[model samples]
Target: MGKPPLSGIRVVEFAGIGPGPFAGMMLADHGAEVIRIDRTRPGGLSLAIDAKDPLLRSRRSVSLDLKNPDAIAAVRRIVRDADAIIEGFRPGVMERLGLGPDVLLGDNPRLVYGRMTGWGQTGPRAHEPGHDINYVALSGVLHALGRAGEKPTPPINLAGDFGGGAMFLAFGMLAALLHAQRTGEGQVVDAAMTEGSSVLMSMMWGFRAMGRWRDERGTNLLDTAAHFYDTYETSDGKYVSLGAIEPQFYAEFRRVAGLDDAKWDRQMDQGGWPALKDELTALFRTRSRDEWVALFEGHDICFAPVLGFDEARADPHNVARGAFVEAGGVSQPAPAPRYSVSDTVVPQMAGARDDAGLLRELGFGDAEIAALGH
Candidate 1:
């Protein structure tokens, strides 16, 4: 196979939690040389960086005290040779540390400065402290989740943190990198979880605009209001998801599931959904999850067993596709979006790394490297 698409690119990551490291992981997985700037002393909300942490995989790390002027200079030198930088800090935090975009971008005109934050670089809430739940709550996503009369259920930070924040940061940085390559100019990518999460609801927003979606939680077609598109509990207490939205698929589901009642004929009758769903709930409970899986596995119905993390790892289809890989004695998801020629780099375990080699590559002399304690 050819080299990964990002084989020659270099990135300087100011490590933090959540989206920042995830974005760094994505870049490193694609074969970019990502050097992480870890703090000499653990501070703030930063978690303990462990070898088992998949997000911190595939990157070399350098420990530096940002409070020291020497460390700041070392970072500037590092950025001079970097193609991009990833930092997840609130507004003005990097400026206060003298590592803001203006200074770094001036040192390297083609540097893609990627910033990750909950509220973004501006707005009244920009400086406010927030988390994934808070960001998604403000994006109308949390309100749209859960049952009709129930309080909104948070999707455990996936929708806000990784999906909205990290994914957008990665996308923006790559886009800016392309622009920089073409025009020899760098730009700042301010990826806000709030804005990104809002963007994620574009389809729902379109449905609402077209009067096809209700503002109420769980009352919409795709939000569990439809009898043919929801999860059912089996006799063994395991769950399975059904997404037989199309007419033919739903018919196949009914036929395979033995739903011979005339009430199942009018598929789009939303008013009868609750009763039909209740009947399906009882019918599903008559069989075990495995039994249902065996019956629906090869059918036209869009059905799937709602497997837990461990089950997902051992699933036949996932195993066949090599979706999960063992790294650092931990089973985690593999790098995604397969390529025909370029091979994505396998993930490496995070651990202590000597910065001497990397510093020398960035043009640091022995004396300078010694001063930096490499």
Candidate 2:
């Protein structure tokens, strides 16, 4: 077995909720040796057992008292040999703790400092606290994600938190790491959820600029406005999604779904979309979700049944692709983007290593590690 892509790359993650931990998970998933600096206390977080939180997997944990100077010095020692550090806090939180990027990067010139926040390090709202929903709401994503006349639906926290904040933070950190390796100068990566979510809306922004997209939700081509690219409820109340956007795919859809060619001819006629969607809705309800799945199984109509979380885990395609794996007696998504040269292994739970053991690995002596406080 080969080493993971990020093997030998050490990361010190200041334990945080949501995107910060998620970013660390991604790096650890890709073979980075991530050490999470957990707080000595619960710190108001729910702090579930590490086994249940898959995001905290693939990394080791070291509980520390940030208020203690000894603990702070111990972390500085860890950062001295680390390639990067990740934290999610308000603008001046790390600075107040004497662990800001400037100080860390000063000590280690090649450290990639990744900062994750909802509003970024600077700006009017930088110091304010906000969650995933609030971030996406500011990014114009929340306004564009619902039915025509209905209230805008929050697409959970996927868009703003994970996709925008965590993914971008990891990406930026890696990129900065590369640059640091080449130039011997590290930099700070300010990955804001609002900025990340806004970047995700780039395509929609272009469409809006070109007058090809409407400002209202559920009225755009890709926003469930088009009959050919929406979900319909099955007779069993399960739903199936369609994306027969092109002419060829739409033709296949018409044939397989047993649609009348004459009536469904004008696929892109905006005025007729509502009626066409109503017809599709009525037609789809005639069969069960499984029946629809069978009809479109091998076809190129871009269709699939909307399976629940349990259903998704047991899905044949997902099973075939090894999309999910069981680790620490928990079933969750496996490491993604498989490598050809380097193999990605199912990550083990990180809490297995005790704090002293983790510190010893970082070259700290037993006595020095003990003096850091519990």
Q: How many residue pairs clash in each candidate?
A: 0, 0
**Model 2 lDDT on a 0 to 1 scale:** 0.89
Per-model TM values vs. the true structure = 0.97, 0.97
Q: How well does model 1 score by local distance difference test?
A: 0.91
lDDT tens digits, residues 1-374, model 2? 58889988999998898899999999999899888988775452323346778998888788888878988898898899999999998899999999988899889999999999999999999999899999999999999999999999999999999998999999999999999989999999999999999999999999999999999999999999999999999999999999999999999999887887687899889999999999898999999999999888899898989999889999999999999898878889999889888977577875554777878888989789878752
Q: Which candidate comes out best when scored by lDDT?
A: 1
Residue 342 lDDT in candidate 2: 90
lDDT of 1 at 265: 98
lDDT at 137, model 2: 94
TM-score of 2: 0.97
